[model samples]
Target: MCLDVVSRLIGLHKLFLFNFYPYVQRFLQPHQREVTRLMQFVAQASHELVPPDVLEPVLRALVNNFVTERNSSDAMAMGLNAIRELCSRAPLVMNQDLLQDLVQYKNYREKSVMMAARALLHLYRVNLPTLLHKRDRGRPTEASIELKVKQYGETDAKDYVPGAEALVNDKGKKKTKEPAEPTEDNSDSDSWVDISDNEGDFEIDTDSEDDDDDDVSLTVLNNIIVTDKHISQEVSCVQVLLGKY
Candidate 1:
């Protein structure tokens, strides 16, 4: 093949692998280069770390063909599985910068993929006493919907609902909606998590004689409203990104 053609193919392959390529890239380009690259990685990681052969069919399903829910879920599951497998095989002290980027993906899209986030969090055992902040990352902190208002970050990076940190209440309340609070044990810090905190104030008390389970579920989403003002600077590092979307 000509050098220019090979270079263009390599660039297209990277774009497709990175999920940045649009609809046309797959059909417009061929799989020849990606297949070759996959073979190289399979051989390299096989001897060194990964179960190279165990994942061949998964790659074939993902990159070798087309997109559908089945393919997409397979891709996500494969990516998540690979992340965990490699994390376990690798030494401790996974790179902080790398972890931050990967954890943010399933959040903004409402994929609720905190499973992978938590897997990585526990694998790396990161206990950032404060938030992993980045400045001016290009994501919207506010949403028009009430269900997702609590999703914002204080740092320049996008705020996130950390792995299983949102919606699971540690404390019980008599009110239909549990009171809003940051999930982090940042008692040392004077900060209060305001994500959806204020919007649910009108919720019917769960303990009230007139209230029922259905009412409780209704008011619960109110906690995720636009007017929430629970932001405080004195929060743990990990919880900082947990509240905002």
Candidate 2:
């Protein structure tokens, strides 16, 4: 509930940082009760809207208090998980050196710690690959390399909505010229129908035999239409009788 509220109300994020983060940092010890929950809150609150400068200190505290070698494997794993969550939301808060150092734990002896570190590394590689070392960054595409990271309070001021470019029309655009109407002279040349030059040699039929076939076809069509109308009327009568009309 608190997470949902903080995420929805951007203003509340600052209050969370000013009030809750400091308290979490103060009690961020292995022996402290709810230390994990405190760290979780801090991580969950690290949204992209919050300035990286403000969140960096909290990230530093998490690293120093729990992610160091001095802490147990469990503590390190929890800290890494929290850091991963934080970075996933606001990766700009983390610096290159810190990120490189964190990724080194992918080779850690503890399996849980190792997995947590890999997850963090994976998150950065996907979102902010430039921050990771070249070797650890993996094969980023040309488009991914060109991806611009959004700064705090930065707005993308596009003139038009994306995917709607084709719908937009320029002012004073000239209308397309329609083709000129074909004259009698050009009609035969332009027409798609292939006319043989020797067409006058063949005898032309004034009355087509197909005229009788067309009349028969019309009669058949009328019969079909009448039969369909009768069937529909019968179905409607049945539906009305069954109170389903």
25-79 per-residue lDDT for model 1 (tens digits) = 3332123445334332322232112233333343333333422233344345444
Candidate 2 Cα misplacement greater than 4 A, ranges: 1-17, 157-245
Q: Local error of candidate 1 at 173, Å? A: 38
Cα deviation in Å at residue 202, candidate 1? 32
Tens digit of per-residue lDDT, candidate 2, span 65-167: 8898988999999989989988887778899989999899999999999999999988988888888887887754443544566677776664322322222
> lDDT scores for all predictions?
0.37, 0.72
Question: What is the Cα-based lDDT of residue 202 in candidate 2?
Answer: 67
Q: Pick the candidate with the highest lDDT.
A: 2
